[model samples]
Structures are given as C-alpha cells and as structure tokens.
Target: MILTELFREQLAYFKDINYAKEIEFLKGFEASEEEIKEFLEKISLQKD
Candidate 1:
C-alpha cells in the first residue's frame, strides 16, 4: 500500500490544483494514464 499512500499524499499536496495539472505532475514521474486513473479511483474509494 505504500505506493497508494504516496499517491494519496501527493494528491493532497496538489488538491488545490487542476486535475489536468495533477496528471501532468504524475506523468513527470512516469506514471501511465491507466495508473493515474486507478490512483484516483482508489483515493475516491478511500473518501467514501
């Protein structure tokens, strides 16, 4: 779960920014589009 935790932490840090920017930032780390989608889904599930 460490990767998920890290993703969540980064997500929180960028919470105020646009979603597109978030995806760009993650892509800078070489994250694929599918990975970004999955990460967002996981974070949303955690919020529920």
Candidate 2:
C-alpha cells in the first residue's frame, strides 16, 4: 500500500487499541484532539 494508506491503517489500529505510542506519534505530527477524532471517524465510516 501507499505510505498514506499505511499510515491511516496504523493510526486506526493504534487508536482502536488505545496504545500509548499512538499518542506520542500523533503529538509528533502536532495533531490536535479534534483532528484525531475526525480522522478516526472517517476511517471507521470507510470500514462500515
């Protein structure tokens, strides 16, 4: 898969598991809580 797709997959998995590393990684991206939530929602919709 492309890098962007791979990232989103990993993000969705980590977020689902509430993994600590996910928080640190997202912080590296300077992602806000709202942005994270929005991304999760989008991925979840695609899954359904």
Candidate 3:
C-alpha cells in the first residue's frame, strides 16, 4: 500500500511536468484554449 501510494505520487508529479511542458509548447504557438483542447483531444484519440 505504501509503495502504491508512492508510485501514485510520482505519477502525479510527472503528469504535472508533462502538462507544464505541453502548456509551454502551446504558448510557443500562441494557442487559445479551444486550440489546446482540440490538440489534447487529438492526442488522446491517437493514444487509444
């Protein structure tokens, strides 16, 4: 249980890092909220 909790914490941390990177990349493109949402949706669809 303790290991599971630790893993979840680390996973969340990495997710935050990735999310920040995505936002930074989007900012470079001057993406609006709708554009970002579309981009993320495309990514999620591709992942599946």
**Model 1 residue 42 distance off true place after TM-score fit, in angstroms:** 0.1
lDDT for 24 in candidate 2 is 57
lDDT of 1 by residue, 1-48 (tens): 877666665653434656555434554578776687677666745731
TM-scores, in order shown?
0.39, 0.40, 0.38
In model 3, the runs with Cα more than 4 Å from the true position are 1-28
Model 2 TM-score is 0.40
Q: lDDT tens string, model 2, 1-48?
A: 466666666665444554455455554568777787778867744631
Residue 41 in candidate 3, Cα distance off native in Å: 0.3
Which lDDT tens digits does candidate 3 get at residues 1-48? 666555544432323434434454554568776675566555543421
Candidates sorted by lDDT, best first: 2, 1, 3
Clashes of 1: 0
lDDT of each: 0.60, 0.62, 0.49
Ranking by TM-score: 2, 1, 3
